[model samples]
Structures are given as C-alpha cells and as structure tokens.
Target: MNLPEILADLQLILEEYQSRLDHYSDQVFMLSPEIGCWSMAEVYSHVFGTCLMQQKAMEMCMQGQGMEGSAGLNEMGDKLFALGHFPPGKYEAPEALKSRVQNIHKEDAKALATKLLSRIKSVQSEDILNANEDQRMEHPRLGFLNASQWVHFMLIHTKHHLNQLDRIERKFSMC
Candidate 1:
C-alpha cells in the first residue's frame, strides 16, 4: 500500500486503541477476570511489546538498504492474513514477552500506548516504506517476514488483542 494510506490506517488504529484505554478507570485497567484473562492494561502492554519488536525489525531491514519480495509471498505469512485474524487458542508468549503485560499501572499504560503510536509514526516516511521488501526477520510463528509484513503484523496484532480487551471489559463488568 502507498505511504499515505498506510499511515492513515496506522493512525486510526493507534488512536482507537488509545482512546479506549484512556476511558477506563484504574480498577478496570488492571483487573483480570480470572487466572488466564488479561486486564486492559495488560493487553496494552503486550501489544506495545509486539509493536516495538516489529518496528525494530523494519528499521533494521530499511537500514540494510534492500527491497526484495512483497509480504504475502511467504506461505506462512500468507496463511496468517488468509485466516483474516489471529487464530483462536492460547499460545504461550515467550517468557521475556510475558512480563510485558504484568505489573502495569494505568499511567504506564498510557505512556506505552503513546510510545507505540510514536513508533508507528516513525516508520511513516516514504524512504522506510519504499525500503527493500526482501529483507526479513525471524517471526516466532510466521517464520521470516519482510518489513512491510512486519508493519502488517503490528496492525493485526493490536487488533487481535483489542478483541481480547473487549472480552475482558465485558467479563470484568459482570464481576
């Protein structure tokens, strides 16, 4: 997609997430309904980590000065999008990433959301978007993904957890 289109979508996604989180009370932000469920703050923290990782990968690829294959060329990457959403199941996040969503204060969540938004904006330049698509980084599940696909992952990942946030909110309200 073109730079303007991508940037606009990214902005919208980021703003929507930020606005939703901003409206929550501290109790709601930190309340996990049960042993496995994540509170809204936890969800934000997790999405922040994923977005940060993707941003770093894209920056590295852009710095390498190569633009190769497009995103959907990889079978695994294609399958991820083809599913139209994150798969339904409990996948374990790596230990390092698991801590991301824990022990977060409401203020911390806001800061993280802002940081994520800034990271998205940082990659909006034409040069970065036009960078070689061939360069890739290892994604734990999807294998190697190019810079563009990494950006796509950032968008999709947030949306996925945002779904979780909705469920968490609904369930927490009943408690």
Candidate 2:
C-alpha cells in the first residue's frame, strides 16, 4: 500500500481509539460493570506504550547500531506476547497491568501518539522504501525490524490495539 493509504488508515484508527477513550475515561478505568477486567485506563496505557515504542523505533533503526537487525522486533515481540498475553490477542488484565501505573501510562500514550505523528510526517517516500535491510536498531523489547517490517509492524500493531480499544469501548462505554 502507498503512504496515503497507510496514513489514512492510521488516522481512522487513532480516531476510533480517541473516541473510545473520551467516552469511557470519565467512567473509571476498568471494563465496565466493574468487571475488573483490563481497565480502560490500562488499555490506554498499553496502546500508548506500544505507539511510543513504535515511534522510537525510527530513531533506533536510524541510529542504534545494536543487535536488533531487521527481524529483531518480531522475535522479541513474539516472545513477550507469548509470555503475558492470551492469543489471538488480548490486553493484559489491570491487576496484571500494575497498580501504580495509571495516570503516567495514559500520559505516555498521548505523548507517544503525538511524537509518532510528528516523526511520521517527516518521513520521505524514499526513506520508507529504501532503508537498508542489515541496518539494525535495538528496540526495548523487540530488537530490530528492517525498514519494511517496521512500517508494517507499526501499522499492524496500531490496528491491533485499536481493536482492543474498541472492545474496551463496547464493554465499558456508557452509551
């Protein structure tokens, strides 16, 4: 897909996520009926964390001469997901998410999205298609992803969390 399409989808996903947060944040964090599931607060935190990590990847890809070459992100991600989450994919439960990690997490998510948008806007077409394969970046969890996979992973991961965000909206939303 082209940049326009990729960006368009990202915008739509962000809108969906924002709407969910706006509708539910005021109520209380957890999936409603107070089921004590993953809180809206926690979901927000996770999405935010993931987005920040993604935005940070560009820098790592560009600068971190560490071991996280192209396939690094996937390998690390698969392992992390395998350890903590249930598949097909589900956000970790709030108790599972951390007690002290509320407001800070939410803020982190916002910062990540904001930064990601800034960096993404600066990406030239050539940069996207022409990044070196063996060129590597050391991410916090997933090590590195070649340029193409990183782009794909970034979009794919955003959509995945958007789905999670949607679920949180449905379960906890007042509407």
Candidate 3:
C-alpha cells in the first residue's frame, strides 16, 4: 500500500478512538463498566505498550538499527496471529507494564491517548515508505511482524479494543 493510504488509515483510527474516549471522559472511573474489565484507560495503555511501540520498532529497523528479536515469543505470537490472535507470551509484556496499567487513572488515560496519537502522527511520510512491509526486522520482545503488518496491528488492535470500550461506555447513561 502507498504511504498516504497507510498514514490516512492510521490517522482515521486515532481520531475515531479519541472521539469515542472523549464521550466517556465525563463518566466516573468506577462506573465505566469496563471497570474490572480492562477499562478504557487500560486499553489505551495496552495500545501503547503492545502496538504503538512495536510500530516505532519497525520504523527503527528501516533505519538500519533493527530491533532485538525473540524467536521464542515471536514464534508464539506469529502462531496466534495465524489463528487470528496475538499471544501474550512471557516477555510479551513485562510485569511492570501490567502494574502501570492497573494503576492508571482517568486523567492519565486522556493524557496517554493524546501522547499516542501525537507520536503516531509524528511518523514522517518518508519513513512510512522507507519502512516497507517487505523489510524484515527483529522485535525486542516477540520478533518479526513485517513492517506493514506491525502498523496494521496497531490500527486493527486499537480499533478492536476501542469497540470493546464503546460497549463498556454504552452501559452508562452519560448523555
């Protein structure tokens, strides 16, 4: 796909996510239905830890500084990917990450969502073209996810969880 197409799709995804989350900002954290269920805050945090960072890693690889790979987990995530899922391997996410998410506040979630969109938008057009999906790189945690697929993961996964967040938010009569 052309760089513009990829970037535009990513931008749309971010905008949609932010719009949905904004609607829930006025709701109480305790009442946000996804309460014990990976709240909106947790989902945003996971998008950063799991997908956004991976996109950056792939970008780095295109610059000749390939990411550190982990065949063990890569193999596992890939297997799950083939089955239409991503496995949460041991090294897939550190304990610190889970801890961070569990403690995240609503305000923090808004801030994180802002930061993620900003960073995602900051990726240059040239960089997108440079980081072709055909280019392979080692991933720090779970190895390779062709450059294109890495970005796709970020978009698709974020959209998927955002849908979940919508369901949770719907439980409230915030309107």
Candidate 4:
C-alpha cells in the first residue's frame, strides 16, 4: 500500500483497538482464553510494543542509518507483502522474545496504542517520505524491508491480531 493508504488504515486499526479497551473489564483483559495462550492484555502489549519497534526501524531508515546495500526482501517477505496479510495459523515468537509478552493493565495498553498511533502519524514528514528505498532492515522471519514496507507490515500485523482478539472475546463469553 502507499503511504497515505497505510496511514489511514493504521489510524483506523489503532483507533479500533483503543476504543475496545474500555469494553474489557480487568478480569476479561487478563484472562487467557485457554492454557498456553496469551491473554487479551498480553496480545495488546505485544502488538503495540512490536509496532513501536517497527516504527523505530522506519525512523532509522529515514535518518539513513539503515544498512546500505541492494538487499531485497527474502522469499517470505515477498509472499507476505503480496498476500497483504498473515497466513492463517498460530505464530510463536522466538524463545527469548516470548518472555517480553506480559499481562498489561488496560490503561497501560491504551497508552501504548495511543503512542503507536502518534508515531505513525509523525512518519508522514518529508524526511520519512524521502527515505532511501534501497536501504533495508532485516526481520528475523520476514527478511529485509525498507521504510515503506515496514509501515505496511505494521498494518498487516495489527489487522492479523484482530481475529485473535475476537477469538479471545468469544472464549470469554463462553465461560
């Protein structure tokens, strides 16, 4: 997607997430739908935190700090962008990163979501728009992506989690 489209979608998804924060009671937010699954709070925390990290990567690219090379997206990255979303299935974070996912408070989650939205908005500046398209950062699973691709990935990632959120809510209602 183009920058404007990416920004609009990002804004909508982030606002949707922020609006739903109040819908969850503390118990529901912290409740895991099943054993070995993340609670809604953990999901929110992970999504927002990962988006922020992606934003920083974008910023680094804008500042010309990205790796200088003709490195292109790996096969997985090409497929992901072509599909414009994650494939259906469960994905596990690396073992080291798994511990970073925590049961966050609803208020804290809301604040992080807000910050991510703000960061997305800030990326519309001239510098970010003019960032070196050839410069790239490597994502462990997805391969190297430039600034615009990073923004697109952020949108895809958040939308992917909406389904997970729905499943969690449904499980909560069933209990």
Report lDDT per candidate.
0.73, 0.56, 0.60, 0.85
Stretches of model 4 off by over 4 angstroms after superposition: none
Q: Candidate 3: give its CA RMSD in angstroms.
A: 4.7
State the lDDT at 59 in candidate 1.
Answer: 82
Question: Which structure among the candidates has the greatest lDDT?
Answer: 4
List the pairs of residues colliding in candidate 1: 66-132, 67-132, 67-133, 68-133, 68-134
The most accurate candidate by TM-score is: 4
- Give the least accurate 10-residue stretch of model 2, judged by summed lDDT: 91-100
Tell me the deviation in Å of residue 83 in model 3.
9.0
After aligning candidate 1 to the native by TM-score, how far in Å is the CA of 153 from where it should be? 0.7
lDDT per residue (tens digit) for residues 27-130 in model 4: 88998889999999999988998888888888888778888784678898899999999999999986655778889999899889889888787777456578
101: Cα error in model 2, Å: 5.5
- Residue 140 of candidate 2: its Cα lDDT? 48
Model 1 agreement with the true structure over 46-134: per-residue lDDT tens digits: 87767887788878777773344534246656787677567887667777778655757778877877987887776665766777767
Q: What would the TM-score be for candidate 3 when compared with the true structure?
A: 0.67
Tens digits of per-residue lDDT, candidate 3, 19-52, equal 6665665445434364346655666667655655
Task: List the candidates ranked by lDDT, beginning with the highest.
Answer: 4, 1, 3, 2
lDDT of 3: 0.60
**TM per candidate:** 0.83, 0.64, 0.67, 0.94
